[model samples]
Target: MHNIPIRNLSARLVDPFQREYYYLRLSITDVCNFRCNYCLPNGYQPHPERDKFLNVDEIRRVVRAFAAMGTEKVRLTGGEPTLRKDFVEIVENIADMENIHTLALTTNGYRMAKDVAAWRKAGITSINVSVDSLNSRQFHRITGEDKFDDVMRGIERAFDVGYQKIKINSVLMKDYNDGELAQFLAWIKHRPIQMRFIELMQTGEMDHFFQRHHLSGQLLADKLVQQGWQLQPKGRTDGPAKVFSHPDYQGEIGLIMPYEKHFCTSCNRLRVSAKGKLHLCLFGEEGTDIRDLLQSDNQQLLLQARLFAALQGKREHHYLHQGDSGVRTNLASIGG
Candidate 1:
């Protein structure tokens, strides 16, 4: 499937500011199994109206609409996408689209052992596994679950299935996993997986969470350098990671500092929530409701027009830490 030739869209999809968006983060469900402290805290209730979410056919048509507008890649996210009953079907259908060049998955890795091979067969080219803490006790504390061993098994299965580009996404918090930096660096010394450390962002209930626990990726990298780890720049870039490789390590280490806002400059992706809202920025509360357009009389034409209008109104950057700006809903609902 990697050999599938590319084709150009008749009309390119460009934002009002002239930024070409070629990436789409499509969330299939808002239901998840694990509740991470920063994302879904205790007593968090799931979105009750499951019937309101788009079904398989609606998802296919919506993906095609985005693909037709020059969306080169689609990354499936969720509260946990594997929690979707039709996860395989949804992924395969999107993978079958001719205009979409790549399909990816961002999962909690709780079900990777059972689903990774099927996802790979369905044309998923890359994966991001959320593993906040390597220590089982810390993992349970951070994610409100005792599934650290399960996640480890999932990662092993993903690797055994030949996913060389597996990325481990760790959300760094000062009082939490911040001290695990050395442990993570050592863990990647002989593995092929890329370790990406992300600075905790002020999202949802985590708005106040970051002020106390936020950890800087720059500080971590600088610490690694001070500890005598040689860091060299890696060629090529994808998504928002700042990639670096150590001479003695087999895997690369990456940093994503959302607070610094460096990644916003080359922002090329848009997000579609499970409820069919097109969110131009991760921190935006308001979005154009594309679900209604998808169910309308002339979906194709209407979807095209609605998407353009949404993109035209897209914010240039998210103001999460400043003023009173930031999304109000939990990350699960917004598919972060």
Candidate 2:
């Protein structure tokens, strides 16, 4: 597609609330193999009527536009991004862009042991793996995958490669893995991993499940503070995680509490679906299609104009606190 000259692109993507976006989460696919109870309990279903996900060229054009508009970080997400045969090629294409400094990835970690080194060489600067529970049985119950040992091996394999520190994402749920926080902390005490605890968020399809299992992340934050863990300041491109560090532990704790007051104040990221639809917020309205503008390099100016117009309508914050999850039925579809 398009490779508009970088110098010709001079506008930065900013919202009405004055939030300048510097990070872009681009989903490569919505097909995940794991059956996480919270996200895709039944497994990923393909819609025959929908168009196919973005190809390498289309993705390159999208990232190019963002990079020229001052987006510095790009996170390659998916139901599992590595599942694509062209995943490495996609990584290489974006990694070679001019203004994008950080090329990160979020995965389920099933293939990390087999393909991490190749990914590192292709320009993946950081990795975040989903490790819901330390207990094998509990993890299986949560993810519906019996490969917990294999996933843990994959993490160790990551360390063996060149990753100085890896981020671990765990969705905390009531009466599920909530009681195992101590076990998680002990495991990461001597490691360089950042354990991120995300509160279970409600989606359109998971109302009853949310009512049954949702837990507040503030409780964990309060506990950490009482235990002498000091809160760390966030970086410009950091996600919505309140990180905590301790004097004795090598690892850090991050709390992602969507229900917390002013949780969206530090919002600095935007999302684009696998099919090239820009999503203004995680829990906002349906996405705006931009695939037509990605077909040729001549459409770069129009695509940038469309992006700027869309940002003007972005809501100040997500409606999660008001019991509204917007059009999101599951996180997998939007690369959450």
Candidate 3:
């Protein structure tokens, strides 16, 4: 069966990037469990605080509508996706939709110790766990919660729950965790996890880190090469990470340069934030608010208008222009 629901709209679906954006990211909540320095503002902007949020049933309807509009892959995200009360129910509901091909989630993994099996039972086959440091002290420094043991327990539980592939995401910042890149990479080697080294974007609370220290993906890949591991490049795809592999290892590693450049022009995905806002571009300041439409269950012309705006919002590329593209926010709010 065709993964997209575009049978009615395919003829009009002229992919500006030569392929339809097959991926959809649905942020179920903006609330996270960790107080990562790079994520929330000091102690002021806590995770439990509400800006605007969506109900589980409301999110299911939105995903169903997206499935009808030709989206096939859906990944649930959040400040921490697992924090939502009906997190597993949301996953199961989306998985039951025939149009969705892949269902995934990215999380901080601090809360998955006991719930991992339940998460798997909900039909999630893959997971990406965000771990910036393996060192306990440094880890606590970054997340403000020395729940390293908890995070590791989650990883173990993910494997026990039968998650096919697990990728570990490590954000590289100068002096902070950059010194531990090789350590982090080596830690995941031979394991069921792919190690991803992400460059710190000058967004969110990470602005403090960006000004204080810096590093790049190219540099990290080079470091791996020096350690006698062959960095084999994987061809680009709509998926987030720009993948690479180690010749002798079973996992992969990657870098996503959202600030330096975005995979936009060819961008095929759109984000429905937990707050019921449609963000076409991760860096796009404008979010088409569909909260009212979602609340009223209005599937009128406005729905199509929102889709049009989302498509029109797709730029040939992100504003990685040398000086001042003005994306100072961090990945926390965007659900990366």
Candidate 4:
């Protein structure tokens, strides 16, 4: 229903640094089923309070405010967003927004084979699935799940259902899947998939694991460049991945190196936790609660005002390089 001109809406989301945010990462839930070694190694623990995640109405209010303020892309994320019974309804609600041109999902691929077609019908424009390793055993070891075949089938199902291109996210770790770059590249050579190698990031609860397995994404990026993969320019709402393409292959490669210098200068996205907290930075301090203002559709102006005021406090860059992970205990908590 927001018929506001794009030019006017764009100015409202700009921060003091003059960076305009057009992307929003909204987490729908924090309960994940998989126990990834680097993230929720012990699986998701139910909070004592059992806090309720944002309902459909709340989600609509949040999306409405952001869309009205020039957010063109909205990504539905979670510890496992598909776990929600109303997941499809959530997608439809956001898809109904006229201002949101891109509706994406970041999933673990556990449900892709069975639910992807339904997801596509509900309006997910893009999909990114986490595939830590190509090897079945290695994937099981890294993710603590024995669903490698299931995930692979899910990818195939996505393509069979008309998805032209899919993005695969792999978290690179030392002595782990780090040696499988060539294997990954070869697999994606003829496929329309973007294989993204994400550097293992340090979090408060996983410092020991991070220290043991952290691998630099730059190594992979440099290797790709040397192999004739040309770097591609990023879109305004693109994530931090440095994408590269090769003339000989139908696929592409993306490197997400958070440790690299000037990593946050091109930031165009903001994150909101499943419980309605606004996170200025992925590795920043505690989030600012914006849920109170999301109670009603009439709170749109106040919500936007709170968002603009909060954006001013966003630091230019995260202190991840200085061994500071801020208050984030795990990536799944904030839908990272």
Candidate 5:
């Protein structure tokens, strides 16, 4: 039995697992501009109505409700958040909220050059750009799009603005960009950003590409050290990433090892889909539609019930341990 007081959402303000989860990943849209081979298969079809996304007002209301229940950080993600017509409007609304300490975005960076200023004014100070490779051929091969130039322009422009802690998220593939890890490190050493090496989990469109070259985070780190890289433990976060850095290297490296091991015990985060479904775990195929409860007659009571339901819904660990591809959802559609 826990003695902590229940907040507005009937959230015990403490998870049963003993972790204080204060961050919420909100997927505002399921649409994306680029069709990364790993994210979606070749025959992938975009959502029919990308314009029919969750309105800014609804997003704010939900953010406020979650904040009341101890949500202090929020990240706006999508197939591409920049692709949203009112993406800036949504960020502005969340940033103005008194309770939210951080409001960030994860994008392919195709439109960062155009939206960095607006995003900064709207209350998003940090941004994560997904760049799979620096080589043009590899870039096109990975993203299946030729918008690499646009993405590069976005990165430069983002740094030009007040946006600091700019992070480059690279999903490592087995046979594809596995050998270019050193090139990635060399590039980041001179820049003012953090380069992240994410272990590709066997899931989504990449399921077919899983065994071709599944590299562990440890292997990547070992390679980094072999390249005359000096690293030290930086810190930890709710998500994946065992962070390290090189001496005098302005940027650091984050190694996200979600599938290699599980961190469910201290996990205290929940993700909300664009359509208002609350996910207890990323690999969860089923979710409690908190949208209905939030709009019900007795919202407060319903909210508490929803919280309890979400907690009870939390599986002890993700099914990845079964020797299967652990990633259950697309990273872009879901907030990474």
Candidate 6:
């Protein structure tokens, strides 16, 4: 609490590898309604207890500390962040922070239909909707729920609520939704939304899931190019997605290959799980517990020091292919 002075806007959380992190993916809760086969298998139990999650005040202070340290963007994630009762209040508080220039959200789009208007009013810059399969029956099979109709309605409601640039995220699986690539491309031909085809990662339950359904995102992109779609650069410097748009269509497409192609060199984000654990890498097993540290005295300085220490040791790239990394918690438990 007595050493380095707070640098405010000029401060950057630089890791030993020299990558500066200015984006924070804050998980509000680990509780989710949908039980996706890829994220949560039959026996997997997420953070089912609400009391264990960080309180609204704790969340506000944590974000404020990061904001002071030059966090320009904050994306609210969760098992489903909108499932939390204080979802609106949390967004509002983050929006009020001076240093946060952009606020984005990633959701399964289950409850977004009912809350899109509130999200629009709260200054949410953009949204990423995880719609794995467009087919109703296959959607139910993959997600273990029949909310496909509801999710589609939510995406439509987001457009109606004035969300200009909505992104659709679909995890490609070999035997699952892989056959829908052409269908997905056709569906977005005239739509304004950018559909991103993500490579299925080897996360928690995904080890077994990968055996039956691991499709490469690069192959899908090749097919798009073969079909005469112009792969123009998106010019976005922040996210991991390699975005491309076509001249003939109104919509755009992207590919996120965290497994096949790791973009860790340009990785500039940190994740805070619902239980207040600060994760330097998405696949990292070690993390600093902010929940306990926040309860300590001289919170600002303490948080600053701890955060800086965490950054100093941030790994250059996550060891996903290595056996050590696959033994972590469920993907839903980590964040969306």
| Better-scoring candidate (lDDT), 2 or 6 | 2
Question: Which 10 consecutive positions of candidate 3 have the poorest summed lDDT?
Answer: 5-14
Task: Please write out the lDDT profile of model 1 over residues 1-336, one tens digit for every residue.
Answer: 222333542356688778888888898888788879888876347555545677887787678778878888899998888888888888887787876777988998888888789889978889999989889999999999899998899899988998886899999888889878778888898998789888777765666886889877888778767766565553222677777777788888888877775557778888898888888888875877888777643466678778887788877777764734465567786666
Q: Any idea what lDDT model 1 has?
A: 0.79
1-336: candidate 2 lDDT, tens digit per residue: 334467557579988888999999999999999999999999988978788999998999899888888899999999899999999999998897988989999999999999999999999999999999999999999999998998899899999999999999999999989999899889889999999999999999899999999999989999999999999999998988999999989999999999998999889999999999999989998999999999987778888889989999999988899899999999998788
Q: Which residue pairs in candidate 5 have backbone atoms (N, alpha carbon, C) closer than 3 angstroms, thus clashing?
A: 174-213, 241-256
Backbone clashes counted, model 4: 0
User: Compared to the true structure, candidate 4 yields what TM-score?
Assistant: 0.97
Candidate 3, pairs of clashing residues: 21-268, 203-328, 203-329, 203-330, 204-329, 204-330, 264-267, 265-316
Top of the candidates by lDDT: 2
In angstroms, what RMSD does candidate 2 have relative to the true structure? Answer: 1.2
What is the lDDT, from 0 to 100, of the residue 160 in candidate 3?
78
What is the Cα-based lDDT of residue 92 in candidate 4? Answer: 90
What global local distance difference test value does model 4 have?
0.91
- Give the distance in Å from residue 50's predicted Cα in candidate 6 to where it truly belongs: 7.7
Cα TM-score per model? 0.91, 0.98, 0.87, 0.97, 0.88, 0.92
TM-score of candidate 3 on Cα atoms, chains taken together: 0.87
| Regions more than 4 Å wrong, model 6 | 1-10, 43-51, 230-237, 296-298, 323-327
State the C-alpha lDDT per candidate: 0.79, 0.92, 0.71, 0.91, 0.72, 0.79
When 1 and 6 are scored with TM-score, the better candidate is: 6
Query: What is the model-wide C-alpha lDDT for candidate 6?
Result: 0.79
The TM-score that candidate 5 achieves is 0.88
Which should have the higher TM-score, number 3 or number 6?
6
- Of 1 and 4, the candidate ahead on lDDT is 4
Clashing residue pairs, candidate 2? 2-297
